[model samples]
Target: MTDKDLRRAVLDELDFDPSLDAGDIGVAVSEGVVTLTGHVGSYAEKVEAERAVRRVRGVRAIAQEIAVRYADAKKVADDQIAARALAIIDWSVHLPKDAIQVTVSGGWITLTGAVPWRYQSRSAEAVVRQLSGVLGVTNRIAIEPRVPPGAVKDKILEAFRRSALFEADAIKVTVSGDRVILEGAVTARAERDAAERAAWSVPGVRAVEDRIVAMARADKMRCTAARIRDRSSIPETNARGTDPSGGRKDTKCSDRGACPVA
Candidate 1:
């Protein structure tokens, strides 16, 4: 696609996403690389903008330059933001409250602590980024695996076998220390992401490096995109799109957890 066409397509995709207010953001394209500029209400919105663009074809990579400038004139104290951040994390069942520590300075919240799964770490960030005074969030939380390496591999493989979403034998799972590596090819993007999530669900997984590739089939890509678009539509009253008990990521509906796809 021409640079002009690619730029327009990206801008339109950003406009179509319901989880963010794209008004202040600017889109620029050079070749296949997409760059985002301007200001967003929060760091969460900035992330949403990039994700929206990635769905479009011909996007080689993303350079996110958007700034998080809280538009509220009423200046909020760092102490207040810290207290609110703690409250938000405490209330979420998906996060272990004692496992997360929060600190705020200049409206930038920094999270430090250890969690078992990457999704929980992402969930903590997801919850705090929507708060009013947050200019940005720095996730310093680390994953400390709790399960034995042998058990972790078994757990992930069992999860894959139980689910009919994709073929289990086609994928390979490797564990070293607390890190899990998925190396194989899948037929769809959702299936690839599902494998990552399955690996994270195991108790002792500190990191999940998704080296998984998908077959370069046009029909598969189209179906995968359609699935993401359909699932991302305005979630129900429960802000987190899926149940915490569900195998999917335990995500909050307000931020990256839930988004409306067009």
Candidate 2:
């Protein structure tokens, strides 16, 4: 079958609402793989969108570029799930609470910030995957360890002693409970990435927020940095497009915990 026919077949198989805001769906075909792009409102719909495209007979692989937009309640639920997942990872000793940034749009979650491991990279994704409302995730977190605090400077010194990616002495680390904070500077992006990975490997860290400057400003970085509390998952079962929760709530806890009492 022709590629156009194949694309059509893919769209026909998956369950999608024609009335929904699917105008963001962008379709491109190369070889047998189909790349799907667009802003969806929830993770469930995003998955369903991919499933719809995947069912097409000639498609061999799918590249999902679809973003989840938190325009209402369901999207808000997915965002909370994303936040809780990151918080769980932050429970680690080496992971810093401020080091990671989590955002959920619709059901698609984007993770930015830094960590210190290849395992942590996968670990972060695994945590998010278990979340109830997640549809897909984009992980753009970097790994690189900084110098440890004076009291534990030896630990930082030991962490990157043999690494070519870090200057070792140029960065500093501070830890409180499981929250880790990295300070100081690095001359290159690779060093920054390596240092983040090392910090993530340390035990008891809950999160990390890197303030290190890159050697050069990098583009091609996806714009997934969103204010998690500012958006809500507006349910799809509507005609007037009015948010029942009166827009996004200003609380950190979502469906995973008690909704904050006003």
Candidate 3:
């Protein structure tokens, strides 16, 4: 559909009175993908607005470019990065407690958070991405940095210790300040997922940037990877997924199946 048609569709579907007026919401549509722009007060509001647009018929994908601006500049600097980060985490329904930290310097943003699951780290990223005026993000989040390197060797090792997802000693793990990088050849997709989960579990980590090369022994990687789920049940599913019969088209996957069914 045309961009105007998409904007009008989104505007019609969104019900909340955003902190800002409807005119402030910038809508861009190209090739059926809709992007929401402009500013809001809270990340939750920004998300609801996106949901509104996705509910409209003819929407294929959504790119949320909504910014969360502070009520006042005085509130910006006064809210320390760690404080702001924690507050964001505390306020978010999806983020976990005792898994994240915030570091800000002259406007630069650094997230130091950890979680047992790689998905949690990803959730933390999404949470911070909506913050207003986030200059740059230095993700120092790690997965399982608690284990001794001499003992664990790599993420695969740590994952084995915790979740039994992969070999304990097969994966290679390295830490450079806030970045925890993982590398190794694995036989299955679960092993890769385990490595990523371990990397994200470490405290004081910002980003578990992985560079591991997969060496699937059998077709397990191919078979298991297909079972990986994208969205979670914590956040309410976009009703757009289900048709009148509460059934959605099997082919209606996302750009990356990241938000399958809408």
Instruction: TM-score each candidate.
Output: 0.69, 0.33, 0.40
After aligning candidate 3 to the native by TM-score, how far in Å is the CA of 101 from where it should be? Answer: 3.4
Best by lDDT: 1
Show model 3 residue runs off by greater than 4 Å: 1-3, 16-21, 42-44, 63-68, 71-74, 87-99, 106-108, 122-262
Where is model 1 more than 4 Å wrong at Cα? 1-6, 30-32, 57-60, 72-74, 160-171, 184-192, 213-262
lDDT of 3 by residue, 101-186 (tens): 88777556677856654556667767765666454456677665445544334543445567665665455566665566675445
**Candidate with the larger lDDT of 1 and 2:** 1
Candidate 2 versus truth, CA RMSD in Å, comes to 21.3
Instruction: Give me the runs in candidate 2 sitting further than 4 Å from their true place.
Output: 1-134, 137-153, 216-262
Task: Predict model 2's lDDT versus the native.
Answer: 0.58
The lDDT, on a scale of 0 to 1, for candidate 1 is 0.75
lDDT per residue, candidate 2, 188-216, as tens digits?
A: 44566677767666543446655443322
Ranked by TM-score from best down, the candidates are: 1, 3, 2
Which scores better on lDDT, 2 or 3?
Answer: 2
Clash count (model 2, backbone only)? 56
- For model 1, what is the error of residue 112's alpha carbon versus the real structure, in angstroms, after optimal superposition? 1.4
Q: Of 1 and 3, which scores higher on lDDT? A: 1
- Model 3 lDDT-worst window of ten: 253-262
- The 10 consecutive residues of candidate 1 with the worst lDDT sum are 253-262
Over all chains combined, what TM-score does candidate 2 have? Answer: 0.33
